[model samples]
Target: MPTAPAAEPVPSVPSPLIRAFPTAPPPDGLPAERESTAPAATGPASPGGDAARTAAPAVEDDADAARRAARAPGRREQRYQETRARIVDAAADLFADRGFDAVSVVEIAKRAGVVEKTVFNHFPMKEGLVFDADPPMREALLDAVRKRPSGESVSAAAGSFVVAAVGLLGAPEAAEGVARMARVIRGSRTLQVREREILGELTDSLAGLIAEETRAWPGQVEPWLAAHAVLGLYASLLELARDRVLAGVTGPELSGELRRQGRRGLALLQFGLAGYAKRR
Candidate 1:
């Protein structure tokens, strides 16, 4: 009789977090006021650098110019995009004033000067109104990847986008709109779900980009791992941003602190986690 040996189960790698879970959390921990402000770092991820740059930013379709710049858009396609823009804009204004749930698709159509069916045709659901930023956001990420520095890792380019995003949020013109929108989203569960769905889509899109960078196939392990890790970091960073706003942080204070922490996080990611547990 032959003796059989027991097989060992493989352990999965642990997911990383900005801070360990069940702890006090980042928002409660960030200093309410930064002592001083430093200039944003220049990198492939930043908006633009002073040095002679090599990467070309992604060229996205401008809402007003897309149809015209599309090299002779068909009448139907042109009109369709234009209508969708109107619906999105009208929905934004109305939703901002009355709140997400209080507004109806019919009212949105009325405000947009279109039929309800047109709204449905473009959006398929009311929650889409809250997600108009998805297209632009996705395009921004794509630009970061496409225009990343020649030697930088794809992950670093992504991290740079987060840094740039914080700076953009710090702008005086954007502060109120951002804070107001944050309040509105916090008030609506449906919009929260839509936002999560968008986040997932973005993760998938980024995964695709990572895979392409390495010439890997869909569902391949490398792209999938990198995508999840970076996107998960992005999720945490964003949640920290939201939490800070709720905690009464405002303006450049919020943006500066976030950008600082964001860059620090990216550095740790780039440097690799060695002896992290043994640290005091």
Candidate 2:
């Protein structure tokens, strides 16, 4: 009985009705208020969401501007090329049909369907339109000389190049084109001087290449002298062909004449100047 008297009283349990319910739904669409008021939540709103939303339009605008910038140069280049080609084609046709001196820039512009100012933009002077026809050919010739075989001498390389160039001149339609150019050049003193200067520059470039190939001295006069001699012979033959065309030569007549002159020139160089070339 004494041990049973020490028994403790049982604790009372709370009623379930007193437990809290979720706070009233935020007024209409105010979710932010409900979230901020709720007990410490597991996850909160992203900190960068507002900044990202605000920056989206700027990023899109920048991307559009960058895309336009990239396309602008290509569009300009295409327009420039189209305008230039139209001018050159018109010039070639006019020069062939009416000769150089008889045609005017206004007439060329009309033929090309462009303003005279546009023609000047592509070619500063009228002569540039005629002379720049085959610029790539000059580059190709230089590349060929630079890439000649190891055993080929400079004279041999030059001879081969001359043969190839003569053949180009002799190709169908090429002779006719040359005749037209000769007429144009002969009619204009400005064109003749420009052409001679261009030829001189080409000769100098070729001489430099020969000097490089032979490892000749920097100030050596022989390479330049040889280049000038060879180029002079070739130029003289070109003038001969031009004179023949002026005198009514055409087709096989012109081709045979040009070939004969070219062979004679090469032979003279080979036999007469055999010992003059830079020994490799």
Candidate 3:
């Protein structure tokens, strides 16, 4: 042979997680060790005649860590909810101090001590932050309807629950939160849409529950009509309460008014009570 070409040396890589630990080669997705000493050894110890060198042990991998974190059953959801709550809390502070339109995602992120991407990841839009309605009302309605005495009508059950809720939530302290919410909704068209969307979702869910009571599927008109009829009363009464809240009503006064009006409407609409409380 006239001439032989020289082999190029491969570049060394660094460890992924640990900086200077003498761990073994990383599994896939993890970075490699920097500056290996194996190349410095002389020709594999001359076929092991001098000594047989052992290979390094396997080490922890970044990919394995990621998999473990993702595999946790409820942890990911819990983290997500915590992040959302943080973003909402931050947005509330900014939106209260400066109007909703005045505050930007960057400002919210800065206040929350999170990145801008995190803010958007929790709330798709600013409106979403305002209308993140984790409604206890929904659960209460469902429970009241389901747990009511066998002869009681759904309307009566739901109406009684509403009155109780007003008493519980209509404390003078609760007015500030409700007023803040009303201000945010009134300030933005998008927030109005979000409010409607959340309301519609609750309506549909209630319809499903009502349908269950009637032993009918979702598409049946009986349950849909019943749910809408009940919700209409709720919506009207709720609007009346909202107006009072915005007008500086609070404490037992607002709650008593709500209970009075809510019950009056419900009492009139009880109609036939689904023949549940019929006289034999």
Candidate 4:
């Protein structure tokens, strides 16, 4: 009983909670420390944000201005072309109805519903209108001569083109139109001169093409002579069709006659002229 009453002093137990240490106080006059170190919040008025927002609008405005400037010239050129085409079409119809000399520039302008000045701006003169309308035919012939198949003789290429031209003349509508055009041309000395000049140009162009294809000198007599012969045959066929149409020929009658003439003419070219040209 005396031993139990003398129980040993109870030992003190340590607590499980960790002890907290106080951080050093901020410097004098400084604000209290924040829990998070993230950047401060900003409004639209902030310097860098304002600069980035302003830069985008300026760049977009500049790009839009450049695009408008680029399309302006193309729109202008398209309008000019449309106006020029109207003037040419009017001139062609007028010339067909009344010979080239018979129609005045003012008349053409009036028919086209445009000012005379506009016509002059495109053509410079009335003859240019007719020449422009008929350019495709001459261009086709020239291209055929220039781009003849490799290893094929120039005479063969020229002969083939001539046959094609004659076939075009045989078309009833073309035959009638050509008859009208021929009459107009014959009626005016000015147009006659222009026609001769155009034909001469065509001949010279063909001669040059032949020279290039054959590797001959441009001024050589042979190429020029061949060009003249080929063009002359084509001219004769054109004249034949025009004369028949003017003589009241039409339909199958005109077509059949033109076909016969074309066969005979082409046969002569194939046998006689082509052989002679090849030898040269």
Candidate 5:
């Protein structure tokens, strides 16, 4: 009988929400700041081959050190994310319990088991903890538009992103968290203003992307118009989530409603709004 071969291991994929960005490569031949000003191994070999024996181990040590250095950034990033999640979770809990304005950043830092400066390092503004996930989402949404398949309209690409996002809220835990966040946002005027500002920023960014892709001339309204339509769908979906969550809808019921409404909203954008709400 012949022995069987071992199975190959599978590579791990990153979660969609917390994908890591690429770090810059380390500089060649040791960093100037870390390395000493010692001369290279250019002189002739020493008597008794002393330098040769020592040089081999030194080179080996350098290689080992380089390997460790290469892995350090990944470890650092993991720790950073872990700390950030702790802070955000603490803030969410506190905000849900005592309202957003009632909970101080100091209390959040204490609950998260980190110093105040550490909290500030992860989130420049207190509001940032509530919307920590926004930056990655913005990137993903824009990437969907930029990398849409041939023959796919921009609305379809943006719509797919929103629908998929809504699908993630199908989980009970996610729905609950969203409900909490929505309640917190409703209670705070600052949050409402921030939300509107974020929407405006997203609209501007999408408009700029559309203008670049379509090569629209200066003062072109088409790109801005299209951008507003797409982002308006996004805003509508957000409001739907807030409404459904508050209504005690959870799990599939909440997500299904969102996805269905999202599709219908996208259809409206695709087909134009001329026939909508006309007197009949």
Candidate 6:
């Protein structure tokens, strides 16, 4: 017994349950300080405590896995969106080259370098391909009015939204697209009907938003009236753009014309047209 070695101290591991879900004081009105200062039990852990300790690490691992999975559009979603865009572009080019009715879904799929089934998967109908942007446009328009700045009228917000959109017609590339779209619509009765349907749908949605914002009574017609008037002004602007595009007006001149017309339209809406155009 000449050299006796001292025992090494063992490090204590914290309970997994305590790390995951800290214990709270019992409902018997025990103080948190008393609970915190309580001595550890020397006896075996209760069944519930053992189960919670066993599950804590698994629960934590699952949460971490979920967080990693929640990141934006991985490779699969990116590929899907890219394919959809290609299909839409191919369909548009083909439709513009030869009228909408003349272009087949098969041809569109071929041009996009995808199978016909893929085209059908993206766009259920030919008309759907033509109006691919409708859903997003509708959402954006409604959002513009819904989120307008304080003190701004809904009509003003909507008018501004439409006017801002006219800038798209002024893009150098947009001139050709606008002209082609106008020609395509003129050549196809189906497209004309579709355009009107889209407009009507827009009007109905805007009217509903107006009603909600104004808290209109059950039978009130004011929201519908306001929606119609605002959208009518928008329709007029669209016609103006179509006419200008067909006439080969684009770039600064096209933008200038649209801005002037849009301002005039907004002005007319703000200040009633009761005084102007009367016999002087």
**Which candidate comes out best when scored by lDDT?**
5
Which regions in candidate 5 have their CA more than 4 angstroms from the true location? 1-70, 273-280
Task: Give candidate 4 regions above 4 Å deviation.
Answer: 1-65, 149-151, 172-176, 217-219, 248-256, 276-280
Q: Give per-residue CA lDDT, model 6, range 56-163, as digits (tens).
A: 666666665665466434545756767877787787778778988899999999998999999988888778776643544567678877876666566666766666
> Residue 70 CA error for candidate 5 (Å)?
4.2
Which candidate number has the best TM-score? 5
Query: For model 1, how does the per-residue alpha-carbon lDDT over 1-280 read when each residue is reduced to its tens digit?
Result: 2111111111111111111111121122222322223333335544555342332222222332454445444554656666776777787778778888889999999988999998898888787666654545576676677776466666666666655554455444544555556766778888788777777887888878777767776557866666666667677776676667667776778768767777677676556522111112
User: In terms of TM-score, how similar is model 6 to the real structure?
Assistant: 0.67
Per-residue lDDT for 115-145 in model 2, tens only?
A: 9998988788787777653343355445655
> What RMSD value applies to candidate 3?
21.1
Q: Write the per-residue lDDT of candidate 5 for residues 26-121, one digit (tens) a residue.
A: 223332334433444444567857777668667766876887798778767867767777787788778888988999999999998999999999
- The lDDT of each candidate is 0.60, 0.61, 0.60, 0.61, 0.67, 0.65
lDDT of 3 at 161: 59
Is 4 or 6 the stronger prediction by lDDT?
6
The runs of at least 3 residues in candidate 3 whose Cα sits more than 4 Å from the true structure, single-residue gaps closed, are 1-84, 217-219, 272-280
Error of 3 at 118 (Å): 1.1
Estimated TM-score for each candidate: 0.61, 0.66, 0.65, 0.68, 0.71, 0.67
lDDT of 4 at 266: 56
TM accuracy, model 5: 0.71
Every model's Cα RMSD, please? 20.8, 33.9, 21.1, 37.4, 12.0, 23.8
Which segments of model 6 are wrong by more than 4 Å? 1-73, 273-280
Model 5, residue 31: distance off in Å is: 26
Q: Model 5, residue 236: what's the lDDT? A: 77
State the lDDT at 55 in candidate 4. Answer: 71
**Candidate 1 Cα outliers beyond 4 Å, as residue runs:** 1-86, 217-219, 246-248, 273-280
After superposition, which runs of candidate 2 have C-alpha atoms over 4 Å from their true positions? Answer: 1-65, 212-219, 240-257, 275-280
Point out the worst 10-residue segment of candidate 2 by lDDT.
12-21
lDDT of 3 by residue, 49-85 (tens): 3453332111233444555566665556656656666
